[model samples]
Target: MDKYRDRSNTLAKERLTRETDKQASQNMAQWLEEFEATKDRVSEIKRVKSRDEDRYYELLDELEITPEYDRYEIIKGYKRDVDALTKEWLKATTPAQRDSCVQAIIGLKSDMVRELMNTQQ
Candidate 1:
């Protein structure tokens, strides 16, 4: 009798767990749908602005562009570093030193290009 009771209890718990998971999944889907609708509504707004508000939004737009400008600066810095490395590689008196500089330049350029591509996306 106790063995039968234990089996039944386990079955009941499993069923309850499955139902809870299903309900939670449904709730999450509904929440995501509502969130997307809210985002769409926000994007559709077209309001006229006063000069001060326009200036404020312009500053905000500039703030958004800041990362792109920073990335440009980073790329420029990488180019400068790579150029310096190239000159060093050229002027190296020893083959070993030249090889080392070549490796450094290759690694730096690869990293810089990867970063540039990733940021553009």
Candidate 2:
């Protein structure tokens, strides 16, 4: 009976881990999709003429809600920080060490962005 109970507990733990991993992957996929969509919008803004861009910014400012320009600035700053960290990690002594650092930094930045997006929504 004890052996059977132990086996059941092990199976339950494995199932929980698998479920957690599955949810994490799904969340990551959704986050990537949202990030890409935001990037495309920002790129579209850059493609517009300066006058048009200024007009757009003015309209957003007038709305008196969350400013699109400010949000874009935050996103850009986050991207720059991530890029710098990536470069620094790559210069590390060993490939394994560099990869570990890169992964950790990416995870931290990703969590920060996720939190920001959640609050804004």
Candidate 3:
């Protein structure tokens, strides 16, 4: 009777583990799908002539960094630190300063794209 009880408990635990693993895999798949969708949307927005400023700001806000810095200063600092530690650039500067830098860089990049578009046109 003791052996039979132990065997049943082992089987039950195995079944539970299998179920948990399946659930975990399903959840991971769902998360990956969502991530891919988000990437696609970002790509589409970036391809537009007018990039989504709100979305860009939303991302900056999500990073918990303020968006208020001189574009050139931020670009200089970011370029210097990008290969090392981007988080440091965000950290060494004030929140508003950091935000300004980010906005400046984005604006610069957008201008460049616009120039390219005009050339192509």
TM-score for all models, in order of appearance: 0.42, 0.46, 0.26
Instruction: Locate the minimum summed-lDDT window of 10 residues in model 3.
Output: 64-73
List per-prediction Cα lDDT, in the order shown: 0.55, 0.56, 0.43
- What is candidate 3's lDDT per residue for 22-92, written digit by digit as tens? 44343423433444555565456555525767876566444333222222223334334332323332344
Per-residue CA lDDT of candidate 2, range 1-121, in tens? 9899778756754553344334434454444455566667656655664659786666545532544444545556666665565556645689787667556565655565565566466
Candidate ranking under lDDT, highest first, comes to 2, 1, 3
List clashing residue pairs in candidate 1. none
For residue 47, model 1's alpha carbon misses the true position, in angstroms, by: 34
Q: Name the candidate, 1 or 3, with the larger lDDT value.
A: 1
> Which pairs clash in model 2?
none
Per-residue lDDT for 34 in model 1?
45
Candidate 3 wrong stretches, greater than 4 Å: 1-91
Model 2 global lDDT (CA atoms, 0 to 1)? 0.56
Q: Mind sharing the TM-score for model 3? A: 0.26
Query: What CA RMSD would you report for each candidate?
Result: 23.4, 13.2, 21.9
TM-score of 2: 0.46
